[model samples]
Target: MKVAGRCGEGSEGMVRVARGPRSAAMPHLVRGMHRVLLALTACGVVAFAGPARADELTGTLKKIHDDGVVVLGVREASIPFSYFDGKRTVGYSQAIAMQIVDEIRKTLGMTQLRVHEITVTSSNRTPMLLNNQIDLECGSTTHTVERENVAAFSDSFFQYAVRMITRKNSGITDFRDLAGKPVVTTAGTSDERLLRSLNTEKQLNMRIMSARDHQEAFSAMKDGRAVAFVMDEPIVYGFKATDPHPDDFIVTGTPLGYEVYACMFRKGDESFRALVNRVIVRSQTSGDAERLYRQWFTQPIPPRGINVNFPLSEQNRALFAHPNDHALD
Candidate 1:
């Protein structure tokens, strides 16, 4: 399957809950009313339905309304997408999450809506979201069929490919070159799954290691713990560029897979998902997302002035031009 993030909005399956009580099951109630309305409309008896009222708010929105707080799942280090830039969480995804928060404030008319950032790793992010410990995650998470089976996702904002970073003298040109070599990827990421599958399917017998995060994976390669660091192309490039000896490493290899990234949340929060998608769709169509891409990928970024220099790909251009939640997988 390709890296499957969408450019448009989509709601797929079941969700966990928010950190608080969602006593107001407005979505279910609305669906029940919708059934009746559809039946009536078929008979030409009822033709109109109005918007939900304040008290009818449900799911994350309802939780936010009641609690006045929006919990955002943030990555401590995903680089350029989402990471702790020393003092705070900042990145392309972080900016998008903030936009969602702004819209949430407007939607609820709550001028004092507080944003709570919780650091999440690749493994725990989903569980935290499912358990209602966090509200939504906007990071470098790949939108996949497996993930959609449990959670909901916003429109696709970014697409990427699986690649690897290796030392220049390592002479690793592509996937085949890494055969029988020690390779590392972040634990719980799609890249790890892809690498393992490659090892098994091709019988490469590659010694695979899993780090907790991107930084750790990079460190593995830097410290000679692994011959290669595998991850998304841009992320590996980000790390390579930022390293003290930028020329010592290179991001190479035929992509193992293609995937898209999106904001994720509980499975059935229609209102909240809509709000998040609006922000994303707005950014794509308005050229805001592209600018952010240039800021993070092509330009120099924080703590150091390293320029990743990854240009936008044709697939992403198509995604931005025609936004949709179509999973590539």
Candidate 2:
């Protein structure tokens, strides 16, 4: 699983977590691999049931497949991943999506496979995939056990660690230090779930508030409605760069948990999921993953702010080395 190329180096070491919520025990990993194999076998056994005519689709993916197009659903808010690029959407995830679609067409021997962008809200993302409105979602989504029930996720292309963001003078040093203090997090996000679980399980006694989006959450921290905002480290760094007063905010707290950011598709569509996973593996093996990351995350911000090069943590490096090859069945 060793990838070729230098593979962007320069970060402190961190432990890699299982992308899916399974035991690190060898037996579980083996079982998971078996399940994926079985699922893919099932997909192979099924008849295509597609059109008799050349390049025509007769089933669920008719509109896009027949038209030789790949529809991607993305969040307009998530930065450094999928965000507005002028009138179009672009980012690391977007670049990965483009490569995936291109590979899909080539691998499947299709003459042309166009890419169509679809905007999706947090709540509608899963539903959109279930209904086949989007073939893939190339946004920053955490791969958690609950989410796995409805959708299949590709091997995580990126790793993120949870952290807290607050004003430099807020005096919040860690999760336990926020007793009775309000923290703003996006609604229906892993950040909200993690914080609430901490309060209950660890008896942290923190007051939590939810915002409709990341912008609102950050605004709450800036306006004093909330003492801090909780999210992954990279996300906080991305937003911190765009802050009107960059020195005003500070990122604090020990890493809570590791998150595996990956592309997602419907649970039952093994062929489609495998197609996306193949692209991810190729990207990592070819040094494209690290290159794309530097382009978006390390490069200088446009209009304002300085270049903030995010160092590659050891955990991510290991993920690139021994990725769960059976991410998609």
Candidate 3:
């Protein structure tokens, strides 16, 4: 996919390997034994004989076990989802990603595991995952059929409505009012695609402008370069809360689209995917997910003491009740 915006900067890309006293050669020894077992099985020497070894883990888990490290892709300013709080990355997604890391430690029976963090943008997150540059992407990424062709998503963790943020008196109350008005959307985001499609399908004659990121998109709206900033509802709220004049803008208009947010990783990794889905499902059923949602959405968070104040929607409550990876269109 072609991403239009400049990616976020200032990621620590921290590489943390758990310190341990285990023999340095243990990983190598395990790998050697794994190869020998595979060879024997392939040669039919052990076919249908003896207990089968657990299916060799592939993708993220395999890489983590081999290298003793896992990489997580994060966002720099996605706020409440994934963002930098001072020098540390903190948000709802960050917390969940750590939970997955803990599960990996248990699954591999490893006393220590390393973690590496990398910053990813809307355009680069999927490509980084596909290239194995990152084992998992924990950011504000929407899952769509087109993205599914290149990567797989975990169970939906959050849902959003695509909406518009404009000055309170802009007279843009709905999609019909957007005709012939300049609108800004972050580059490489679903909002951009939705606006383009609306323009084509409904002949709205909207003048679309792409911003490098949400901050830039909001700047355009503030400076009168664009009459409206179009993006996911949570994100719009995030920006509005942080703006100096929070009361100046309003998120209005009927939703142009609905989005399901989930963590993304490489395709064809069923073992890894299943592990991720299990973690999400367990969190949902145990009420851990709801707690995290409340922490970020209802309560005040760091850097700024602003609360997004978004109550969990009924659609999302249903998703948590019965977690599944299926996309909600």
Best by TM-score: 1
Backbone N/Cα/C clashes per model? 12, 0, 0
* TM-score ranking from best candidate downward: 1, 3, 2
Could you give me the TM-score of model 2 versus the true structure?
0.78
lDDT tens string, model 1, 1-329?
A: 11122222342111122244444755888855655554443222443423335797999989878888999999987888898878899888898899889878867878788999999999899999999999999998888888899899888999888999999999899999888889999999888998999999999999999998889889999999999999989888888777789999988999998999999999978878767876776678667889988998888788676788889999998888667676666
Worst 10 residues of 3 by lDDT: 7-16
User: Higher lDDT: candidate 2 or 3?
Assistant: 3
Residue-by-residue lDDT tens digits, candidate 2, 1-329: 12122212431111122355656565977875655544433233224522234445333244455667778997775766787745678778888888887766654466566777899866678889888888789787778877888888888888878898898987888988888888888887787888898889988777889888777888898899999899878878777877767788888899788788888887766556656766776567556677787787888744353454577778777777665533221
lDDT of 3 by residue, 112-202 (tens): 7888999888777878888889999877899888888888999889888999899998888888898998989999988899889999999
Name the top lDDT candidate: 1
Mark the regions of model 2 whose C-alpha exceeds 4 Å error after superposition.
1-63, 108-112, 301-306, 325-329
**CA lDDT scores, all candidates in order:** 0.82, 0.72, 0.81
lDDT of 3: 0.81
Q: Please tell me which model should have the higher TM-score, number 2 or number 3.
A: 3
* Candidate 1 TM-score, true structure as reference: 0.83
Q: All predictions: root-mean-square deviation over Cα?
A: 9.4, 9.0, 13.2
